[model samples]
Target chain A: MNNEKVWTAGLVVIGDEILSGRTADKNIAQIASWLQVQGIRLAEVRVVADDMDAIAGAVNALRTAYDYLFTTGGIGPTHDDITVDAIAAALGVDVVIHPQARAMLEDYYKDKPGGLNDARLRMARVPDGADLIPNAMSGAPGIRHGNIFLMAGVPAITAQMLHGLTGQLEGGAPLMVETVGCWTAESEVAEILREVEKAHEGCQIGSYPFFREGRTGANFVIRSTSRDVLESAVDTLCEALAETGRDFTPGGI
Target chain B: MNNEKVWTAGLVVIGDEILSGRTADKNIAQIASWLQVQGIRLAEVRVVADDMDAIAGAVNALRTAYDYLFTTGGIGPTHDDITVDAIAAALGVDVVIHPQARAMLEDYYKDKPGGLNDARLRMARVPDGADLIPNAMSGAPGIRHGNIFLMAGVPAITAQMLHGLTGQLEGGAPLMVETVGCWTAESEVAEILREVEKAHEGCQIGSYPFFREGRTGANFVIRSTSRDVLESAVDTLCEALAETGRDFTPGGI
Candidate 1:
C-alpha cells in the first residue's frame, strides 16, 4: 500500500434551485471528476439552499474538515447570489470587490447593451484577501479565499473555474478504478464479491445493482490507489464470477 | 405570511459511486421533488462516501437538525453496503432481522435461482424498532426507524419507497412556484427581481442563468406558500420586465 498522504476536498453546492427541485445539479459530478484528475478525492458534498445561513454553515463545516472546499452556485449577479457574502461571513472576513475582477467585467460588458451597472458589478465582489480564478466562459471570475474556492452556479462557468485551477493544488496519487459487470443478481454472488474484496489488500469493491431490460444485473466497481492492486482485485472478481458460471464484462455494463 | 411551523427534511446520499463521479445522483432531485409534493421542504443534502463513520456522522447530524431524515444507497447485500450498520450505530440500537422483511425477501426470491442465501437474507436486517417501507420495484423493502427512512439507491426502487410514504408524513402547506423566463441576461433584471420579492409578503425569487442558442437567458423562479402572494409576485415581475422593454415567458424557458 502506498503510504502517501491522501488529499481530500469538500464541495458545497449553494442554490435553492437544487434543493427545491427547480433545477437539476450538474456541478457535483463535474467538480468530482475534475478533482479526481487533480488526484484529490471528493470526500463529501452538501447541497444547500440559497439562504445565507445555510450556505455559511456548510462552508464552515466543510472548509475545516477537508484540505480544500469548493462552492458552486449562488454567485451570479442577482439578489439570489449571496454565496460571496455567506462565505465571507463564514471566514469572518469582509466582502470586497476584486480590482482585477471589476476591470475584467468592465471591459467585457462595456460593449454590451447594458454596461457594468451596480447589479453587474456584484459579480466582482469576493471575500477579503481573495484571489480571482479566471472564467473563460464569462468575464466575471471565480473567487478563492485561502483553501475555499467560490465558483459560479452555472455548470459551464464552473467548468472554466475548474480548468483555471487544474494542477494548482497539491494532492496524492490519483485513485484507480476497474469495474466488472454481471448479468446476474448481485445478491446471488454477494459472498463471492465479499471474498474477492477481502483477498485484495488496499482495494475496496462496491456493488451497484440495477434492473434493466427486464433483468437483474450489477456492476462491481473496484477502487484503489495502486493500479496493480486495483487490477488484481478486478481479475480475482472476474475469475470468481466465471467460476460461478456467470458471464462478466470487464469495462462494466 | 403564514405562521405555521414549516417541516424540513435532510437527505444523506450514501454511496462511493456518487463521490467517485462514476454515477450521477438522481435521488436528490427525486426526493426533493417528492418532499415538495408532501408539503415538506428538503432543506439540506449530503453526499457521503460508503464509509461507516461518514454515513453515521451525517445521519446523526441531519436526523436531529430536521423534522425528518432520509438516506439513499449502501443498503445492498455486499460488504461495502454498510448503511444499515452505520445507521443503527447512529441511533444507538442493535441490528436485528425483521420477520416481515425476511418473509418478503423469501417470497421475492423463491421463484428465482439461488433462492434466499445468506447474502439475500441481509436485506431483511434492520435496526431494532424499525418498520418496513414497501419496495414496489423490488422485494427487499426500505426500512423506516423513527423519523429516519433508509431507501434504495436505484431511482426506480427509491420511487416505490417514496410512493409508499406519500401522505404518511406530517407537513405544512405545499410551496407554490411560478417561473418567468426571459431572453435578457438576469443581471440586467437583478433589481427588478429584488424589488418584486420584497413587494410580495411571502414570495422569494431565484434567478437561474442559462446560455443557450448563442444567447443569454434566465429563469426567475418565484416561490410562496400562499397562492395570492405567488401570483402577485409573478405579475409584478412580468410587469417589471416589460417596463425594461424585454420580452418574458410566464412559464419559463
Candidate 2:
C-alpha cells in the first residue's frame, strides 16, 4: 500500500432487488464518484441481498479491510429493513434507540399527522454506540460507527446523507491532474508511455479510449500530488508522441 | 448453505480505467445477468487494475471462494494485457502459447494483411494446462482451467465467449418466478408477505418499489422451484392485500 495518507473505502449495497436484477444499483457509482473527488479511493464494492447472514458477513469483511465502510439499503421502515440488526450483529453489539435519534424523529414528525408510528420507530433503532449522521433530505437520519457510515437505501436519501457527511471527512492534498486529447490507438503509444511512467516516480498514468462522430481516439491522463512532477512527465509524453508523428491537444492542469 | 446443489461464481473486472472513472465497467453486469439466468448465484466480484499483482491477488482469492471464477479484461493485444501472466502467477505456473489457440488465431487472420503480428499473438498466450474456450465474435479464444474462465474484457467478445461456454456448463434447474404487482405502501404489506414466505418452502420473495410521476407502487416478486407452491403464495398475498383495501392486479402466471 502507498502509505501516503491514502484513505481507501468500500461500499456495501444491501438490497435483494439489486441481487434479483429488478433494480440496478445507483449507489456504487454515486459513492465512487464522490470519494474520488475527495482523494479517497473506493477499493471494493459488494452488492448483497437483504439476507441477514450475507449482510453481516460483507459488513464485517469490508469494515476490517478498508479505512472506511459505507452501506446503503435495508434501512427503511419495512420488515425487510434489517440493516440495523445486521450491522449490530456484525459488530457484536446490540440495537438500542439513541435519545438523539428519537428526538430527531419526534421533531421531524411533530408537524405531520399520524407521524412516528410503531413501524416508523424502526428507523430509530441504531446500533449501540453509534452517532447520528444527519440526513438533509429526510428526517430519518443515518448512523456512523468508527468508520462505517450506514445510510438509507433510497438514492435521494443516500445522496443527502453523504453530502452531509462529506464536510466532516479528512481529505488528502490536491492530486494534480493533466489530460491530453486523443489521436491514436492505445497500443501504438504503449512503449513510450511505459518508459515515461518508469521515469516519473510517485505518479500514475491512465489511457482512456473514446469514440465520437465516427472517430476513435484516446486521452492520456496523469495524476500526482506534485505539479512539477506531473508537468515534467506530460512534457516527456508529448515529445515522445510528437516524435512518432502524433499530435495531441493539452487539457486541464 | 442450502442442502441443494449450489453453483457459485465470482467476477473479476480488470482495467485501471474503471478505477479512475474513465471507463464504467459493463462486463460485471452482463456476466451477472447470465449467471442469474442459469441458477448460478454470483458470489462476489472484484475490480482491479491491469497491474500483474493486483490481478493475481483478485483471481487467486475468487478462485478459492467460489465454484467458478470468471475474469474480464487484460486479454487484448495491448501492452497492458497482463491477465495471462497474472493468472499464471496466481496458480503458481507459467503461461505458454497453446497449439489450439494458435491455430484458431491463425485461421482467423489468414486473409487480412499484416494480421497476427507478435503483438496479436500475445492473445494466444494461455496458462499451461488450460483448455481453450471458443470466442465466437473474434477467433482469439478464451481459456478455462479447473473452475476459472478467463475471457476478454471487451463487452462483445466477452458475451460471445460466454455464449460459447454455455453448453459446457452444468447448472441447477431454472428458478421459477411469480410477481404480484402494483401494491402501494410496501410496509403495510409486510406481515402477510412473511406468512406467505413461511408457507412456501425453498422460495425467496422480494419487494421492489417503483416511484414515477408522483405515484408510488411496488412489486412483490416470488421465486420458487414449484409452480403450485408459488401460486398458493401469490393467492394468499393477493387475498391479504385485499383486506388492506389495496386490490392487487393479478397478471399472468
Candidate 3:
C-alpha cells in the first residue's frame, strides 16, 4: 500500500445558469478527471451563484481545506463576470491587471471589433501576486493565485486551462481504475463487492446500478493507487459474479 | 419587487464516482429545476466523496444554511452506501429499519430470485424520526428526515422520487425567466447588460458567451420573481441590442 501523503483539490463552480438549471455543469467532471491524471484527488466541489458573498465564502472555505482549489465561471467580459473580484476578496488581496495578461489580450483582440475596450479589458484583471494560465482557445487567460486557479465557465476554455496546467503541480501516484459489469441486481451481489474491497487494502469499490431495457444491471468500479490491487479486485468481483450464475463483463457494459 | 420570503435549499451530492469524474452528476440540475418550479431557490451545492465524515460534514452544513437540504447517492445495498449511517450520525439519531419500508421491499422482491435478503433489506434502514419519500421507479424508497432529503443517486430513480414529492413542500412564488440571444460578442453588449440589470431593480441578467460556427455569440438570460419585471427587462435588453444593430433572437440561440 502506498502511504504517501495524498494531495487533494477542491473546485468552486460559479454560475447562475448552472444553479438555475439552464446550463448543465461539465467542469466538475472535466476537472475531476484531470486531477486524477495529475495524481491529486478531487476532494470537494461547491457550485455557487454569481454572488460575491457566496463565491467568496465558498472560495475561502475550500481553499483552506484542500491542497489546491480551482474555480470556474464568472471570468468573462460581461457585468456578471465577477470571479476575479470575488477571489481577490477571498484572498484578501487587491485586483490588478497583469502586464502579461494585458499584453496577450491586446495582441489577441487587436484585429477584432471593439478592440480592448473596458469591458474586454476586464479579462486582464487578477488577484495580486497571481500568474496567468494561458487559454489557447480564447483571448482571456485563467488566473492562478497561489494554489487557487480561476478558470472559464465554458468547458472548452477550461480544457485549455487544464492543458496549460498539465503535469505542472507536484502529485503522488495517479489513481488507477477498473470497472466490471454484471447483469444482476447489485443487492444480490453486495456482499461480494464488500468482501473483495475488504480483502484488498487501500482499494475502494463503487457500485452503480442501472435500469435499461426492462432489466436491472450494475457496474462495479474498482479503484486503487496500485494497478495490481485494482486488477485483483476486478478479477475477484468477476469470479464472484460468475459463481452466482450472473453474466459479467470486464470494463463495464 | 416581491418582498416576501425567498425559500431556499442546499444540496449535498455524495459519491466517489462524481469526485473521480466517472459520473457527471444530473441530480443537481434536476433538483435545482424542481426547486425553482416549487418556488424555492437552490442556494448552494456541495459535492463530496463517499467518506463518512465528508458526507456528515456537508449534510450538517447545508441542512442548516437553507430552508431545505437534499442529498443524492450512497443509499443502496452496497458496502459504500453509508449515507444512512452518516445522516443518522449528523442528526444524532439511531438507525432503524422502518416497518413500511421493509414491507414495501418484501412485496417488491417477493417473486424475484432473491427475496428480500439481508443485503436487500438494507434499503429499509433509515434515521430514527425520518419518513420515506416514495420511489416509484424502484422499490427502495428515499429517506426523508425532516427537511433533509436523502435520495438515490441514479437519475431516473431520483426523478421518480421528486415526482412523488412534487407540490408537497411549501415555497414562495415560482421564479420566472426570459432569455435573449445575440449573434454578437457579449463584450460589445456588456454595458447594455449592466445598465438593464441596474434599471430593472430586481431582475438579474446573466451573459453566457459561446463560439459556434467560427463566430462568437452570446445569450443574455433575465430572471426575476415578478413576471412584469422579467418581461420589461427582456424587452429593454432586446431594444438595446436592436439599437446596436446586432441580430438578436428571443428564447436564446
Candidate 4:
C-alpha cells in the first residue's frame, strides 16, 4: 500500500437497520479496503440512524474532517429512503431533481422490460450540482459532491460503485505492514517493546493479544511507509522475543 | 425494556486492529444488545485507532452527546494499552490510583505469585472520582465515572463488566419492533407504502430490499415505543400488502 499521499477517509453508514443490528454493514470494510489499495487511510467510521438531523450532522462533520467521506444507505427508491434530502439539508441547499440524472435513467430503462415510471424515476432525483457515479451492477448511479460520495447500501452494488469510484480518486502511498506471531503474553515483552517503538519512530508498532483453544498469545504488527524501517523494526522485535525464549514466526507483507 | 426514561447511549470501540481489518470488534454489538435490553437506545457507534488523540476525541464527544458512553479496548498491561490515560485526558483530569481499584487487585492476586507489581498495578489506575465496575470473569475491574463506563476490550471480560454495570443504569421504555416480510419489489409497493406511513404518525418504518438465494424481495421493519401504535402500523402494512397479493410474517417484539 502506498503511504506517500496525505489522503484520509471517513465512512458514514446511514441506516436504522444497521444501528439496530438488524443488518450488518459491509460497506465500511469494502470502502476501507478500496481506499487502502488506493493509498488512502480510513481514519474513522460512524453509524447513524436515518433521522434527518443525525444524518445531516454526521455528513457535515465527516465531510469537513476527512479528505474523503463515503456514505452508504438511504438512497433507494422508497419513501423511507431519504438520503438525498438529508444530504441536501446537511449542505444547506435545496433538494432538486437533476436533468442529467433523469436522462441517464431514461436511457437505462428505455429497452428494459420493466418500464420506468414515477416510482422508478425517484432514483433520478439528486441533490443539485452533485456529479453522478456510474453503478456497474445496476443502472441507478451514485452521486458525489465535494468530498462526500453517496452510494447504494447493498453490498454487491456498493462494491461495484466503489471499484469504479476509486479510479477517480488521487491515492496516497500504500502503507507497508510486517508482523511477527508469538505465543507470549504482551506484558512479558514490554521492556524490549519500548525500545523497538523508540527505534522505529516513523512506524506504528502494535501488539494484539489473542486467545484460541485455551492458548494465549499476541500478534505484533509493525507498519510504516519505508520497507527498511518496517524490516528493521521486525528484526528488533524478533530478537527481543527470542531473548524471552518465545517462539516467533515472520508474517507476510 | 422501558423507553420512558429518555436516555441514549453511544459506543466507542478502540484498537487499530479493527480499523486495519486485522480484527472485527465485537464490543459494539455486545454493548448494543445490552443497552437494548435495558431500553436504552444506542444512538451512535465510533470505531477508531489506539491513538491517544483519537481515543480522547471520541470519548469526549460521545460523553457529551449521549446520556451514557461505553468504551472497549486498550486496558491491558502492555505499553500500547493507553486507554486509562486517554480517558483521563478526555475528562481533563489526572490519572490516579484509586484505593478501591487497588484493593480489588490486591484481593485478586493475594495468593498468586508475581502479584500486583508496579507494572501490573498500572491496570488499577483510573480517572479520578470514578467508581469501579466489578469484572466477574477477571479481577481487573472496569471503571465508571458518572455516565461513562470504561471496560476491557476482551469479549469475555467486557461482557462480564457490562452485566455488572447494567443494573445501575436508568432504562428507557422498551422499544417495540414489528416487521413485514413480503415478496414484492420496492417500486411495485410504493403507493400503499406511503399511505401506511402517513397513517401511522408515531412509528418509523424502514424498507430493506434483499436478493437472497436467487429470490428478490424486501423486508419492512416498523419500530416504535408504543405496542398499540406498532401493532396498528403492522396491521395497516399487512392490509396494504394484502391488496398487492403479497404475504408478510410478523417479527420482533
The chain B TM-scores of all candidates, as shown, are 0.99, 0.89, 0.99, 0.90
Model 1 CA deviation exceeding 4 Å by range: none
Q: For each model in turn, which proportion of the native inter-chain contacts is also found?
A: 0.78, 0.18, 0.85, 0.42
Q: Model 2, range A54-112, lDDT digits (tens) per residue?
A: 89988998899888898999877666789999999999999998888888888977765
Each candidate's clash count: 1, 1, 0, 16
Candidate 1 per-residue lDDT over residues A1-253, each given as its tens digit = 6789899999999888899887888988999888988899999999998888998899999999999999998888999899999989988889998999999999999999889999999999998999999997889899888999989888988888999999999988998888899999999899998888898887888999988889999999988999888888888888888888999999999
Q: Which scores higher on lDDT, 1 or 2?
A: 1
RMSD in Å for candidate 1, one decimal? 0.9
Give the per-residue lDDT digits (tens) of candidate 2, residues B1-253: 2467878788787886666555566777788777777877777767776788878888888899888899988886666678999999999988899988888888987775446667668878988999988887667788898889998777778888989877477777556678888647565566677778888788777766555676656778887766777788888888888887776876621
RMSD of 2: 3.4
Model 2 chain A scores worst on lDDT over the 10 consecutive residues at A207-216
Query: lDDT (CA) for every model shown?
Result: 0.92, 0.77, 0.93, 0.80
What is candidate 4's CA lDDT for residue B41? Answer: 86
In the range A1-253, model 3's lDDT, one tens digit per residue, is 6889999999999999999988899999999999999999999999999999999999999999999999999999999999999999987899998999999999998999989999999999999999999999888999999999999999999999999999899988999999898888999999998999999999999999998899999998999999899888888888888888888989898
- Among these predicted structures, which one has the highest DockQ? 3
> Which regions in candidate 2 have their CA more than 4 angstroms from the true location?
A1-3, A106-114, A174-176, A179-183, A208-219, A247-253, B1-3, B103-118, B247-253
For residues B102-180, what per-residue lDDT tens digits would candidate 3 score against the true structure?
Answer: 9999999999988999899999999999999998778999988999999999999999999989999999999899889
Residue B77 displacement (Å), model 2:
3.2
